[model samples]
Target: MRIKYAIPIVFFVALVIIEKENNIISRVSDKLALKQTPQAPIHTSRSGNALPKRNVSVTSLGKPSSAFTLMKRHLEKYSEHQQAAAAVTNGRKDILLLATTRTGSSFVGEFFNQQGDNMFYLYEPLWHVEKMLTLETGGTNATATAKAYCDVLRQLFLCDFSLLERFIEPLPVDHITASLFRRESSSSLCREVVCSPFVKGVYERYRCRNMRCGPLNLTMASESCLLKEHRAIKVVRVRQLETLRPLAEDPRLDVKFIQLVRDPRAVLSSRMVAFPGKYKTWSNWFMNSDVLIDDNEVKKLKSNCDNIRMSVELGLRQPVWLHDRYMLVRYEDVARLPMKKASEIYKFTGIPFTPQVNDWILKSTQASKETRGIYSTQKNSAEQVEKWRFSLPFKAVQLVQKVCGSTLKLFGYKFVTSEEMLRDKSISLIEDFL
Candidate 1:
């Protein structure tokens, strides 16, 4: 009886050792995953008394599973897959602007308040949804995720929102907006205001900012700022042409447009440092990012510019685009004499410039002059804006010149030195426009 029991006990001990070894093997395999963080390392150190440094910041904010990370690794791969057929468009009737990025869209939008009583300035309509998420969670992960989503939304909605009318409504009847766009009223506040095709995409992207859909409001909405109103005529600046195109195309709107452009070299040099790590960086939210173009990225961005150019150029030539009225502004010019440009913009849009509007433009322009685009004569306010000549590197400067030289030349920018001449074929591109 003693021999039989002893034999069984010896077998059980052997099994326990094997099971422990299997667990150790499993832990080893789980660590060092490419897409995921490894488990907490054992706390042993060479001195035995000290533990290793562990970066728990990631874990504290909810470290994704290694499997989730692996799945994310392949996310970019599926980006090329064909999209399902998009839905048809629902039309909107509002004044709109057709233009590109790095343009004075914000400033131009400010000009809209001067257009008249019905005018409403939907400032950074696309940015609200972004602010929504951050305002919701009030933490690092939420902020980071919100920003990334905002970038994705902006990039994905590259085309004018009007083009995808089926999937979206330009002036969606949300709680804050419902008052302006009641179904029973043919003369609703939404129609009264110059809603752009750009509004829908931007609003959709920023919708996250307002879960109560709180007025899709601004941080400064209650600052008691007066309207830069006109009795008649409505105009608004739109930065995204794809969004502007369809909205301006709608027959209900007596749309008037303005296309604003800036120097490409100035554009790139000005933005490189503002957002160091491309769209992923939080710093990019305010600074210009166009200056970091390489050969391929230049190709993509230039294609975007070209599409904008054609759209605006077509609108200028035809009465059908924006009800046949349009104007073009150079951001460089506006930076120098914002008051002058704003005055001229009011005239071109057929609105009487009110004292309030004039004062607003002057004050806003003056206050923001230092930090506005460095294309004008104002001295650099930051190291990032100043190093345009050096920061872009010679090759990147040439790439910008090669891709967007004509657009700059059209705005009367000249190459100042021999270095610029040898590489910039676009030096001659502007003479005809001049």
Candidate 2:
């Protein structure tokens, strides 16, 4: 069969497997003993229910898991050689593209991945850690959690996943996918790790739960971690800006931040449309309440808008030490002029706008009219940005606009009146004039 036709079929099959796997996991989680404790009223969508504990095992690899040991040795040897070469030139950079949900961060992260051999892009390694933290602590302990978060980030930059084992055991599929399968700098070390029994065991466990495993035979280059020029992590999990302060000030690493923001109205509108009746999982990310009092779509949108504003304000109020290391980018600007925006972002991170990066931008953003899911890697950037305007109800838009008025002004996104929403065909979320 042709590649185009086969792609959709494979995606459909994978989607089915993932959905089944989620159901199985939920069932298993419920069946497991809930680890009774003081039963303090913790936060969850299910009202008054405590966070259920799971069987979390922190693998104490005596000899190290075969894959882990091999990867570590390879990275160590490679780093020795790389450090010598890099000493003659500029060292590698560590960049973080930080954003809240529905802000086109996944799209932006792909820019680094497009660098192929030169960049090591980690797609939300901290997501699993966040999950573990919330489960264990009910999302308390801000300071300690922040320290641990930064610590894991530090280790990952140094190409170490063993430090992450305590937080996440048996390695989540997404982690394996990013580190091994889809990575650009997959060396012989990477291949050995991917094909090891450890990864296969995790894949088999996922398969038993009806989840699909990533490809086992994907080819990777020899430049695993030893020779990468840049490492960028795209994260949407951290709510407090203070959590990243330590990372920003680390004397050993050159870290830069790109804070991506979107108009709250557009963000909420997109969320409501894209995930109707299914946002309880991430609704309270920066919000106080879980389920909105009025279980309606408009109320959810309003709540989401409030959360966005709060999150943006928190990110903007960073300490003085982080001032020079940070740059803010708007989703609207990036969607409209992908290459230009990408170039500006590259310049901020000290990465050159290579021809390959530009080519990936064009292909990823301007692909043909195929139905893409919300979690799709490729995006029709311009359409995706402007979609909320026509898709959202006029009244809903008015509510989001009202809640986010100050923030909109802060980001230079003009107010969209109900009348304009009703009659204007060429309404833009962002103001053309500064």
Candidate 3:
């Protein structure tokens, strides 16, 4: 019985030793096989740009697996993918400066233009597109029209100005905006304002070096141009808020709206002085001079007033404003307190208030004795805030007051009668008009 037990024990011990040796040989053989195997080069995209190869742990089929290791590897890859997607998505921002002409939009546009490399600004890109779209749809098919506009706008946001080529072909450079089709045109005021390497390269690529229009550097994609963090446009041609509603609601686009307004009286004064009708005809008066506006001009004025009212009402209807995604800025207020208002604007838009912007504000707003042009680009505060108060005649003031009285009151501008105006120290009568 002892001999039989001893034989079984020896057999068991020998079997265990064989099993251990087999395991050790298997691991050594597996490692040698891995060492002898050649690694293939990672496949890369045709563009020649590729992400680095991930470090993957190698294992033999016979090796025991751990659920924890597998899960950790999977979680690491998932986190990397997520981070890449977020990096691509988080790089873009869209801002629309919604305002009418002669409402100090140019001045306000400068605020965005000064943001250095982070900003890509287009001044009035939609001015001609709005006209073309209006003619094509002709008040019918509102959905199609808005969609068409949005489509073009999307391209613009992506820095694909080539889409505007067809629209710009028939019209002369004077009638149609050249900047929409050709990047180096006067409308790319930022080329002058922001002369960074990126801006310079983009301008060289997108700009129609020749006056002729076609694909501008097809090799340079829209995505490349849109690599900047902020893309903004100051548009005056869009007639209704409805035209922009789709963009505001698009989940893919991170969009914000800024409504820039001026005192109606100021707007009227600026328009009249800039372009006045000599014969006192309605067309001439409405287009040319702000002095002695007749009944016909009043009708046009009322139309402008109605548009403003409708726009404001529409803005109020949108819940985005309540969520801090929308802002209303007055030209007077911005001119009066630039830094304070600029800080507010910067805070709202999530842009840093850079020293360059601060210096611009300080230098631009300094009162100068230099006689600047009526529509000079140089920032002049005294002229900007209340020029109409001094230059407009008593009769012209009264007419503007009557036409835009309700709008004035709504905007908190105190109405001053001709008598009340004459009493103020700043009032200078236009004797020729009187």
Candidate 4:
């Protein structure tokens, strides 16, 4: 398995999982930052459907069962750790809201953060871990390689530099950095980031005892990072379909996963503005040729709208995990009907739902394919979906329509007309399930 293909998407997506870690990439290139800025927000939506809620228990180690637990733990621990408690609850069903760039993830993740008892609305942990794994393994056997990568995480939690250097780009000097590095020093951030969990966790223990570091810094490093509030979920709310072959075997993270998708026309329409005039639009992304590239070529870009769509469709259809456990959600749906979306998530976790979460769902940015005017011809009763038809030029819309016709139809989106179009569009939904 030369992973020659999926590796790029995997490594790239790992960076997406923990966006903050890309502080490394951010430091290096503004171009990279442009694509990532959209992903900086936090959160997810739970579908609000009625169902039998499963049994849940908070662990003896004082673990949180819902998102709120993680939130309270951090806020109580430090005044500065304001928002972004993690989404996982300890000894409880892990709630993972698969978020894509700019699909109102911040509003959704934040909503859950406020609702759950044990959830920590922390920055995207998946992105951080993903990038770390990719850098370490180049997307080869991501599952086996990332398992080894977990030790590095444990080290950072403890702040043990003994082997932490191996995870760093150039490594760092320990005692020298501690003594010479001034407060808020560049070296300090480097040290803090590279340190093992044990080293940092214990050091945080010392800080809690002392009065150094601001309330925010202390809570973020110590309480949020060290406290036994919420346990990490076995979730990989990750993209990058091909590289996931290795990850598919990890029983913890392998259970069920979700992918966020949007119409390529809409994706390119916004992305055109997101990037500067230089190579900005789909034209720039696609080499600006009048001729359009087919699906096979799009998959090579990995991050491209068409590529991600194919990957998501294929991953769902051919999962290493079981069907009963696997799931999928649309980014547009998450933005449109958050409560309904959140309710679906609650079902996946097999947890109970509360009115409080339901009410929270009513509140959202209300930005989706519907409101944003991106549409599917399915008789789903369109509210405002169809952004591409309205926003993009006739040529751009036609280009996306021609190239992505098959993908759109596979997901149940209807083409304007023509038997060939519909046949090309239809996906193996039954094959995907049966």
Residue-wise C-alpha lDDT for candidate 2, range 1-434, written one tens digit per residue: 59989999999999997786545434323212132223211222223343332222112112236887678757765765665465336767888887877888888887886776677777676766666656755553444445556666765665545345445543333223322322322222233333423344333322211223333221121125435777787777665555666666544467887888887767776665567667543444324434343447556555545555665565567557676677788888898899988998888787788888789788888766683677665778888777767665565556667656677787888777666654475765577642
Q: What TM-score fits each model?
A: 0.45, 0.65, 0.63, 0.47
| Residue 272, model 3: Cα distance from true site in angstroms | 1.6
Kindly report which residue stretches of model 2 are placed more than 4 angstroms away from their true locations once superposed.
Answer: 1-89, 138-144, 171-223, 279-320
Give the Cα-based TM-score of candidate 2 against the true structure. Answer: 0.65
lDDT of 1 by residue, 205-253 (tens): 2232112232221111211111222112122222234444433432223
Backbone atom clashes (below 3 Å) for every candidate: 16, 0, 6, 72
TM-score of 3: 0.63
Writing each residue's lDDT as its tens digit, candidate 3 over 1-434 gives 99989999999999997786555445433432343234312323336564243232233223565898778867866775665466447856677888887887877777777777677777776655555544543432333334445655755664554444334434322112323432543333323322222333222334433243332321122333455777887877555665676566444456677888777777777776667653255334444655444666678787787677577667756665235557777777787788888888878787787887788777777746574555544567745776666655566567767887776665666667655664475653221110
Compute the lDDT of residue 229 as modeled in candidate 2.
Answer: 76
- Model 4 spans with C-alpha error above 4 angstroms: 1-91, 95-104, 126-239, 245-255, 277-311, 318-320, 354-356, 366-385, 416-434
Candidates ranked by TM-score, best first?
A: 2, 3, 4, 1
Cα-based lDDT for every prediction: 0.41, 0.60, 0.58, 0.40
- Give the range of the ten consecutive residues with the poorest summed lDDT in model 4: 53-62
Q: Which stretches of candidate 1 lie over 4 Å from their true place?
A: 1-94, 114-118, 126-249, 279-295, 319-323, 368-391, 416-434
RMSD of each: 21.0, 17.3, 24.4, 16.4
Q: Which candidate is the best by TM-score?
A: 2
Cα displacement (angstroms), candidate 1, residue 271, comes to: 3.0
